[model samples]
Target: MTTLPDSFLSLPIAHRGYHDAGSGIIENTRAAFRAAIEAGYGIELDVQLSADGHAMVFHDYEMSRLTGETGPIRTRNRDALTRIILKNTDETIPALPEILSLIAGRVPLLIEAKDQDGAMGPDIGPLEQSVADALKDYAGPVAVMSFNPHSVIRLAALAPNVPRGLVTCHFPAEHWQLLNEKTRTRLRAIPDYMRAGASFISHRHDDLANPRISELRAAGASIICWTVRSFEAEIEARKLADNITFEGYRAAVGTG
Candidate 1:
């Protein structure tokens, strides 16, 4: 039962490392991370496993969106993946270790392990283990989370000392077509909060008023929400969330 530190909750987090694609700072790349660190905001990024099992800091499972290449991210080894320059930038995809070394505890990090198991089921591993291995020796104010509870459960076993959380959201059927109705219904309620050994939850910002969120807060879980794009939205989210993960605009530091 590791606790989330105050630093993690004190400042607004930059969703995907303060990315601004128009400025050549792509999401989850070194440039974006550097921007976040320079801006004095906490960072929240996603990680996926490369073919050889190295942890890569990226959001998409496929390369087509972020890179010129076309294939699943796991199809490429770390070295090859690192060479595929991000679209519109000279920067290549960064490995977890590279970003960790760059940040070096300068600000709190909230890392989300992308669900390799497309159905958000139990077929998880290599990625969580790689993340654990990366963090084993690093000293930082950091936490790991995922939309998949099984991934968080795995993190508890692999890196028990680091704080763990769940990325929660309303499972709107149209948006979550891959998840069956039963699965969506079960997850929408967030029943795994206790079972996953989560210290906090980074829920969807617009869904903050969901009663389950209130229930979790009542049970003492630190409430955080994601993708707050405007200061007005931040003000609204803060009413229910202990902190916010934001992007697209500058979030005032130490003000919430």
Candidate 2:
């Protein structure tokens, strides 16, 4: 297993590195990422391929939700992708490698594999391999996680010891105990996640601070909550889990 950085394992992550500055630069852009690094928070960003197979920093499969582009991200070339103005900022889409280099040794990164409409996981291996290859000699901590746990298990075959987090939503109240043999069969083999080396559990904000979270922590799983937008949510989330994933890293982060 790769030795994570000293403060790497215990720090909160800024989701897409604090992009909403009312400046037009949306999440996953170079401006946002730079803001994150400068703020000294760990980074968590997503990746998808351009039309020509270049891995670029982006979170969703379609730009319609975040960027107002009605097409899939993969349909556009790098230049084409970069040309779309970020929601508020003058910045354009950013290349993953460029973002990586900008962060340098500043903080840990969680790179998520993304595809439009959730139909093309099989095509992710090469993209996964390419991203991993790019970060091979990276001195800072790095990990790849997906909401599709199968992709994580698949990536395991090629990249061993790379930490993966099981990204889930609306986690059941009984997340720690293994019950219901049927759902167990269909689920991503969560035990396999622990067995394979998932150091963290990333769940929605609502799921934090529950008994199940305590249970997972008892099992040595690091609990991380997602997209904390408000000060109240941030305070409460910090009380429940080991780390939090926030989208608004733009504000001066104090205490919790």
Candidate 3:
């Protein structure tokens, strides 16, 4: 394993490629991915198992939000999924393997998988073997991430050497004092994240700078921020995060 950076953890990261709002080049699409790769940016995209256990690139819980469909994406096979028109364009969701093959070694891909929660229609259940199986032959830098800690555990077990990142953010639900107390306990156990063989962490830049990242870094973990677009935030985060993922690929100081 190569050593990464503490400042790299806080760098400017793009939010799923630099697609303008309401533009056809939306996040997780092949066009957006290509743009990111061409721009030399570290790209972040989502992956979910299809009906046939093949990984498909997507970020939403359903296609309705992007494609205006009422059904789920996992229910359809590659052909069917490919046929489902995406927005105004004829392009459909691309398979994960295909995306990797296309990108080759041009850039690194950050894959965020769905949780075991079966609520968002049907897809492959949370299984380490399943995720590992799909990524077995993938060359170049690959990192798996999910909000579900259990999924992180399973992925670590299946692929001991593969880097896993735990994605988390504070939701507006609990009281400050209560949330702080609960967060402390959660933070303590997070060192166990290293036990999960996690090489990096994909979290909000604010979270990385909140002392938690330093704690995790002490455990020999790479801290990476998600969706850092602001210039000020980028500068501040560069002091904390090890690798910065951006959409436009404006190379600054440091590398992953």
- TM-scores of the candidates are 0.98, 0.80, 0.79
Which 10 consecutive positions of candidate 3 have the poorest summed lDDT?
2-11
Candidate 3 lDDT over residue span 1-256, tens digit each: 3233332343234456545535667777778777766665666777766676666777765778888676677677776776777787657887777778776756666778875444211232443466687678877766777765667777766776666777755433342233445544554345446544566677666666566668777877777776666656677767777766554335453444
Alpha-carbon RMSD of each model: 0.8, 4.8, 4.7
Instruction: Tell me how far the alpha carbon of residue 217 in candidate 1 is from the true structure, in angstroms, after superposition.
Output: 0.3
CA lDDT, every prediction? 0.93, 0.68, 0.63
lDDT at position 86, candidate 2: 64
In candidate 1 the C-alpha lDDT for residue 248 amounts to: 91
Runs off by more than 4 Å, candidate 3:
1-14, 21-23, 118-128, 174-191, 246-256
Model 2 ranges with Cα > 4 A deviation? 1-6, 66-68, 115-123, 171-191, 209-211, 249-256
Off by over 4 Å in 1: none
Q: Over all chains combined, what TM-score does candidate 2 have?
A: 0.80
- Give the local distance difference test score of model 1: 0.93
- Per residue, candidate 2 scores C-alpha lDDT tens digits across 1-256 of 2323435446667788767667654678787778777777788898887887777888766788767577888889888988887665677788777887888868788887763324323445656666666677776678777765556666566566676667755434365243354543434334445544666767778766456567767877776778788767878887777667887534334443
Ranking by lDDT: 1, 2, 3
